[model samples]
Target chain A: MKKLSRNQTFMLITIPVLVLFFVFNTLPLIKGFMYSFTNFKGFGSYDMVGIRNYTDLFTDARVGKSYLFTFKFAVLATIVTNVIGLLLALGLNGKIRAKSALRGIYFVPRILGGLVVGYIFGYIFTYILPALGLGSSMLSSTKTAWIAIVIVAAWQAIAQTTLIYISGLQTVPADVYEAGAIDGATGWIQFKELTFPLIIPFFSINLVLSMKDFLMVFDQIMALTKGGPAQSTESISYLIYQNGITGGQFGFQSANAVIFFIVIVAISVFQLNFTSKKEEQL
Target chain B: MNKKNKVAATTNWPVTILLILGCLTVIFPLYMALVIALKKPSEMTNDIAGALSLPKSWSLENFSEAMRVTDFWHSLGYSIMITVVTVVLAILIHSLAGYAIGRCMAKSKFYKFSYLYIVSGMFVPFAILMMPLVKQTAQMGIDNWFGVILCYLVFYMPMNIMLYTGYLKNIPIALEEAATIDGATTWSTYWKVIFPIMKPMHATVAVLTALGTWNDVMTPLVIMSGTGANTLPLAQLTFQTQFGTNYNLAFASYLLALIPILIFYLVCQKQIINGVVNGAVK
Candidate 1:
């Protein structure tokens, strides 16, 4: 070990992650990517088809709907979760009784698996709520599926977002707010001038994280809707999975995945750059 | 001026209302679920809404039946195996790789390698490879609890490296350097000096990993669909069937899924708090 060269050291360390990545992810990813350019079912050798997979995927309405639904969910979840979460933080931040226990109660859902959540909430959505006259098919129908999914997504995410907001809120300059108060600044005005400006970074965190969350909303959809009453809840993750695994359209699925990959990477890069700029500007 | 003061006081109502609403929103679903879980099948279908209240007669029958039906003890053990092994292996490998990549290796290659693994890890969504990952793992004959553990490492390794590396950047190398000078080998120096020092990160990673693997359903569902390898998540997914109208057993099982995590979250609550507050938990 002492006699090992720098290159040797790199090999020693990088090899584990790299091997695991290659065997598990990178290789399959490449295989998937390559197959996307071909006509491979899960069976034998695949033909080297051209851009057909990409063309078909784009031309398909259901495929396009998945991305749109995913994007919409991400947007709504980010906004709702952050706004509510920030409000929760601001409320809880003040001298409150039993804050710790309240925090634990709020934080419980965050700790449980999403499948459990999906089941628990699925029971609520499909059964319990209906018993109380709330519509049961909210998740099943196209018109209200968006709101249902966003609500569920927000419910699962608010605790973490609340924590983030609390962290962000703690660093706000107390004196600036006091001065704003002296100037007869109202509650809304103080938040607009003080809280909003200083907490822009937290907002960015909330946005990007929600993006991640929305993109990966699979188990919930799978459990709750299975992409249906009429494909209302189709999402990118679920779509890729259907194409790749269930439908066995490996080539088309791979194309969808690669495109999905590019979209995600692009969004993440854009978010990072955009948020940093906001952080600087604010 | 007095009107303005009154207006300001009235406006704060939104915050107060939102605070109570947010807490209720967070807690009531779980509360509802718990209420259902404690009820009998007879109580469930008779009145779903009424079933959400405390049971007229609190019964441990649903729990015992849930335990028997889901084969709760076996799956619990398997869940423990999956969580413990994945958490240990993921942390150790990541910390080692993080330390070497950050300090021990040459700058040029290290930077490129770091970006290769960590950055790409962030961009590609897991759903893209989930299908193929399942197939590949099945092909490798690890489509069981062990497979679940390995899959977790692959799924979570990126996160571990990304987190530990970020934390390591904040850690000074002087301690490791001093240890090396005193004839401590690289491994021991890492174990004694570097590892312990990264305790916050360790605790964070452990809790995070445990939370993740314990809560995981998709990976297990995809890969380990075989008998004798079902996780608590898979059990919970089918909980609806076991007590379909009996919201009690369903929610009971959901709460059971939650018990381990709640214990985990409480035990490492401080460490988790430190991690969340310290920046990089996300």
Candidate 2:
């Protein structure tokens, strides 16, 4: 048997993965990009629509509404989940009784599948909460739909984010908080000066991850309201999904997917740059 | 609420109160799921608020019945098969890719290309290419368990690879070098020396993958959007179709859906806590 050099063997293994990635991801990406430029319905050729598709997507009221909803969800869920998660993490990571059990309890929702979360929460919203006269449909009303989605997302996310925050919080030198306490700076001053600044890196990573997951969430939306009452909960990803699958507007949906990809990448880069620049200025 | 006994002067009280409330918040929904699942239909309808308060009567009928309606046993069987296979495959493939990337850091071209490609691929929304992938998978005759597993393999790769790569970087190369000096072959070195060392990491990866795959809905929902696909999430689709509006049964199923992962969560709380505490999580 001819023993391949480490580099040769490494390439042999990874090249196939890269190739598969191209087949599954990169090629499809190219196809998506191309479709965004055309009026292809899904299958074969169509009118070479140029940038009209992009123009239409922005100008169209429905598409824009979904984008607005998505932004609201991503931004809100991102903030709330991180804040609550961080709070939980800090609380639990400290010397506490039954921290393990508490951690387990906090994480139960995170362990659930999105569909199950949607269904279970949908039940609570539609059946349980409404029995107390909360709302007719937890997913139907516009204001309430966003709120419901946020609450549910937060619930599922608390455990995971808390876990991140716990690590971040624990990693902060105990002497910092202790020094603050000794100096009578242990209150909001301590958190602002010590905890907040220290955990920023965790916050950024968690924020990005939370945003990514929130942007991609579909199952909960589908199972919860199917983006309804009156399409009030229709997120950008869901819109693409509806167009692609149920409507079979493959080309249109694919175009939206490509656009979504570009927007996310732009947003991520923008976030990183903005935060890093802010840090430099600080 | 008081000035002298302010929140800061407290010893973890603020955190403790929030922890109590947070634990209750998670428990309430979980309790609702379980109690309602076990309660008789008549009892549930008559006294849901009471049933939710505590288990008035516990039995497996609701579970079995919901299972019957949703093809519960068959669907779970399918789900278990898919999730188990996918988890195994994810650990194996991701470890290899991660090791290669970690050891071959000087392989700049490969690293650069992968960094650009994999991270970029993450932002590639699935909607656009669902059409092509659906077509491709159908063409490849991977339209069953094989199709689902392949989709999971692709879905899971980027994140796991990212994680493994990061983790492998943290380990010292001298550890592996010492093994090599002791006449250890590459395979044995990885298997006996490196693999054992990577256990905590493996546990983290396993928990994440298993939990994530079990919770996934969109992949199977879209891929097997056919009747009889019966993934756990698909079975949770009781609300979508015009049916009995069996909210109670749906909640029953939702509760049941959580059991497997909840068990895993309970079992691995320590590992998960350490993983989170050690900064090993997503």
Candidate 3:
């Protein structure tokens, strides 16, 4: 058999994958953009509405509330998970017995499905916590419902972030700590001066990943609260999913989704730029 | 080295204490789930302290009942099938494409541009595509298991491709050149030479894809809803309402869903952690 040319080989390899990608990935994106400008209700013929959905998004209360809740949840969850994860990573990285076993235990939550974790915690918040006199169901109130979501989200999310931080921590050479110890710097001071600066890249990665992931929080909200009590914990992804796909607000939700897409991109890019600059300074 | 030895010899009591506490927090929920799932509903007193106690009988009744109510085996079958197929296909197809693009992009602008085009999908959130995708899949008569698998493949493509391509960079072209000099065709060279060499990356992609597919709720919920078919996560959500007051059954079902991934994690904890860190850092 004759050997194929480089371009021929490349085309042979990529054509099928690219076609499938375009059909499943790119087409929906393009269609979503087009539908955002229309009055399509996910079925039947519809006329283009010419920015009506986008305009309505500006004045929409539920949309605004969902965005607020999502951002608030993302920020809180990011901080909570990163702090806890970093601390846990620090502990795990220390000289310890059965270190791998401990690391495996901490990572359990990362492997479980989000919906399952949410449901387990849903029962906890509703029954166990209240029974423990923590308070009446955290999922029952608008004010505190988001807190439950954050706790559950962080519980699962911290697993990976902690692992990432541990990886980051391992990259710090023991000699640096030795140098600090010789200078009489103790634990906290050594960490602050020697360890922290070296791990900024990992910290930034965790921050950006956690932020992006939590921004699109959906499964946990569904299993825990279903965007209740009174849509208080409804994330942007949940809103788009529940309202757009199931509620026949296809075009409207597509508009929201497009904006959501832009916001995520902007935030990711901004965070990357911000963190990269900080990394350089260090 | 003396300082390091002294630090290591002390056992780091504070860090050890922190790790133990963190371990407690991590293990607490799983223990609660297990305890709750093993008990009868009648044994679950309204008081939290009572619920925290070990089950009096330690029966698998709730597990059996949960299996009946949730159609647990059916959903488990679907989850396994979907995850297996998606992981297998993702590894094979993405590796091939990655090999082509990773190898040829330097010499071919088209391949480089294609690489960018494909990877740019990474930035587009699934939210933007959810509604249109539902319509597209429905119109294509594939809004079922096949469609769900296809979505997973495409959804995971950008990241998998990126990872594979990056991994391929470390593999010397001399191997492929040697194969060619031995009169191996492109296909033969890829399969005989490149494929085996990419095992580590294949494992990374498989593990990541399997975890994502098995744990995903949103995609299956969007595509497979109303079709009477359910992945494990979707099945859990579907029965959430029915499991309303039956906390034991709910916990039992949650435990049932958790078992497979839990086992997978146990077997591959180190690789999973390294794969996640590799994916994140790259």
Candidate 4:
């Protein structure tokens, strides 16, 4: 065998992975961008229509509605999940008995697939809620369906967020709380100044992650509402999937997708920057 | 501090009760699945309490039927295969690239560019590439398990590489330098001297990738569509759609899909939770 230099050996091992990344990941992104400008509808040849797909997106009400619903859902889900998760972490972080088992119970839902959670919650919304005299099935109308979607998404995500928060809580030195107590800081005050500031990074992580996930929500929507009740809960991901795969409007959906990608990237970058700046400021 | 502990040890009962109730509420949807899955078909219609009602007679018939209809064992095997292969290969590839980037290739221009290229992928949002990915995979004659696994490998690479690279950066180069002085090849130095030290990152990467692959629906939905090689999620989707009204079987399928992952999580809960916390904190 030839004696390969260190750099050469590094290149040899890394190239295959890089090639696979390029072909499957980068290439699709590039092709998706290219296809957005054309009338390409699956196979065969197509002419580039310049910015027609892009311009047409403005006229697409479903895409707009999906974005609106997705943003609303993302915000609601993120807030609910983080708040509930933080509360759970705070409670579990204390010297509770069977704390590990309780923590495990809290995180159990996260291990289930989103699709499965959606279906399970769908069952609850459709049958149990009505039977319990909680009015009609929440999924029967646009407004209520969006609530169900948010609830299911939060349910699916809360466990992981709680776990993250618990870890963050565990990191704050016990002395910090002891000193706060000695200085006559109440429980709420201590949490605000000590626990909250120390765990801000974990908060940012959960916030950004939940927002991104909720915006791209698809499988759950598919299982729960199927974006029904007049497509009230069609998230960006579901909208793109519907338009591209089921509706055969690949080009138009690709345009929506490209815009969606830009929006998500912008949001993520902005969130990280904003949060990190806050972390430093605090 | 003594007062706080005394309060936590005594007057916290109500709050602890509330926490238990809250945790129960969070996990209620999953409990619903198990309840419905255990009920017989006749009981499902008559159970007025719905998800809250315990089955008068618990049976495994629904499970067996769900297993038969959804091809649960086959799909489980397929999902396991895909997750295992993708996770193992991704870790190996990412570690090699990460090792190179964090060590020998640290000062190279390619490393700088490649670092930004790979990490930028974390924000690209796979929805943007969905349509093109579907077409590209079909065109490549790999719209099957191979294609799905390949997509997972590519989609997951950036995060895995980021983790491995960041972890490797903290280790001193002295060990590798000593190995080099002993005339060991670059490859052996990584495998023998460096790889073993990456146990924690490996744990993080493994848990992260494994959970992602096992729970992912969109990629498999797009890539494996009509290929008749369904993973567990896809199989459950098909089962639900086909048996739209059969709540018994649907919930059973959902539970069947959930059991393996639940077992896995329970077994590796500590490691997985630690991995997630470490991934976020770092």
* Weakest lDDT window of 10 consecutive positions for candidate 3 chain B: B1-10
Tell me the tens digit of each residue's lDDT in model 3 across B1-282: 576667676667767766777788889889999999999989987787667899998799999999999999999999999999999999899999999899888988888988999998988999998998888889999999999999999999999999999998999889999988888788889999999999988888988898899999999988988689888889998998899888889899999999988888878887888777788887
TM-score of 4: 0.97
Candidate 4 C-alpha lDDT tens digits along A44-65: 6888999999988998898889
Worst 10 residues of 1 chain B by lDDT: B273-282
Candidate 1, lDDT over the whole model? 0.75
Native contacts conserved, per model: 0.56, 0.56, 0.81, 0.70
Sorted into a CAPRI-style docking class, model 4 comes out as medium
Q: Give TM per candidate.
A: 0.91, 0.91, 0.97, 0.97
Per-residue alpha-carbon lDDT of candidate 1 for residues A1-282, written as tens digits (9 for 90 to 100): 255544565568777767776787787777677778988776677788899999999898989988888888888888898887887787766555566766666666677677777766776677667777785657666798777777877888887888877878888877776678788764688788877888888778877877787778887776677787688788888887776776868888888888988888898999999989887875
Sorted into a CAPRI-style docking class, model 3 comes out as medium
Q: How many steric clashes between backbone atoms does each model show? A: 3, 2, 0, 0
Say what the RMSD of model 4 is: 1.7
Off by over 4 Å in 2: A38-48, A278-282, B1-18, B45-56, B175-188, B238-243, B273-282
Candidate 4: list runs displaced more than 4 Å: B1-5, B9-11, B50-52
lDDT of 3 at A154: 95
Write down the DockQ of candidate 1: 0.49
Clashing pairs in 4: none
